[model samples]
Target: MRNILTLAGKDFRSLATSPMFCLIAALCSVMWSFTFLRSLILFAENTQATFNPGPSPTLQMTVFLTHISQINLLFVFIVPALTMRLLAEEKKLRTYDLLLTAPITATEIALGKFLGAFGVILILVALSFLYPLATYPIAHFSFPPLLAAYLGVILVASTYVAVGVFASSLTQSVVLSVVMGLVFNLFLWFLSQGAESATGLYMTSVLEQISIGDHFMAFIRGSIRLKSIMFLLSCTGLFVFLTQRVVESSRWR
Candidate 1:
């Protein structure tokens, strides 16, 4: 346990000092600020207009949820960059042998790396949450729906990190890891939408069940379903397990 935490801390510190981390963090802060300002500005305009009988459409659940969804798009771009070096760079620098010969098991190494990367992602997500928090006092938004959407955002981000960590384990080239992660992200997006066009009931059902976006949409729409949560978590666990396998295999090479 101590060794795992030590390794995880090292990874977090390594990323913190890297120029790439600064660039990515700056880009994320700028984009999130712009999106939040745009959303709030729209709501302020609505409040300024003459009162309507209908509910405030400007500050509805969709508006806040859209901000979360928009962040997911940004995740698709930066997550690969964030995780591409987890194991790939270690291999490239020939430090993997040191890891392989260490007293800790491959599972520990993989889990530690995963914990570190995911921790960083959660920090970014938490910072972005301030946007929604900014509106609560003025907009009177429901907390439950907002919480559910936040869950969805975290789940989606976790899935991306899982895919990225696995990709990083597959090769020593950071470029290859990024390419693989991007392709996988795009592929999942297409599966979510493309399933609507399928003819066979069983086949379509399978595709939709596995579509990360489809499950994510349920939460975005303020629906809490156990199946969706399980699905996302299961995928995360699967990829982490696969990463462990990769590390184990690399030990012999």
Candidate 2:
């Protein structure tokens, strides 16, 4: 456990020192903030012009929450890029052997890298809080749904990071890892759409259950369902387990 923690700490420091991390973080933060603020301003302007009153608290909260929820699709792409190098870069540089020679098992090394990547993701998600905070002065602003949306975002992003880590473990090229992660995500998206178009009720239900966008839409609308929470957790666990298995298999080579 101590060795895992130390490894996780090292991974965290390496990510912090990397220019790619800073560049992507800055890009996501700025783009999301700009889009969200634009929506807020447009909402306020429309309300004042049409209703002869300022935006209501409920509406403001809803808009902000929706923006936060919807913007996670961006993180879906960005997280893979962040995690793609977690294992691939280590392998490419031959540092993975040194780590493996230490007290840490393959599972610990894989999981520690995942946790460190997740920590970086958590920080990025937290940075989006500025959107909700901007609505603090409004009368109808409630923090509960915003908190829930943030939770949902973190859950989804964590799952993506785990998936990317698994992809990274499959190959020693960061670019391949990124492409695999994106392809996997895109495939799920297509599955969701195809399931929706199927004729049978059972098929449609199954598709909705697996639809990442469908599950996230509930949280975006300030509604939390047990199914969505379970889906994200399941996805995270599945990918993390796969990553450990992949890393373990490589040890016999």
Q: Candidate 1: which stretches are off by over 4 Å?
A: 47-60
> What's the number of clashes in each of the models?
0, 0
Q: Each prediction's Cα RMSD?
A: 1.9, 2.6
Models 1 onward score TM values of 0.93, 0.91
Q: For residues 169-238, could you state the per-residue lDDT of candidate 2 as single tens digits? A: 8899989999998888766667788885889999898887887878876776667889899999999889
Q: Which stretches of candidate 2 lie above 4 Å from their native place?
A: 51-57, 60-62, 138-140
* Candidate number achieving the greatest lDDT relative to the actual structure: 1
Which 10-residue span in candidate 1 carries the lowest summed lDDT? 56-65
Task: Return the lDDT, model 1, position 61.
Answer: 58
Candidate 1 lDDT tens digits, 1-253: 8877988889888887788888888888898788778877876776788697877564545567668888898999888899999999999999988888889998899889888888888878887888889878876767887788889999989988988999999999999999998988878778866679988998899899999988988897778899999999998899899999999987576
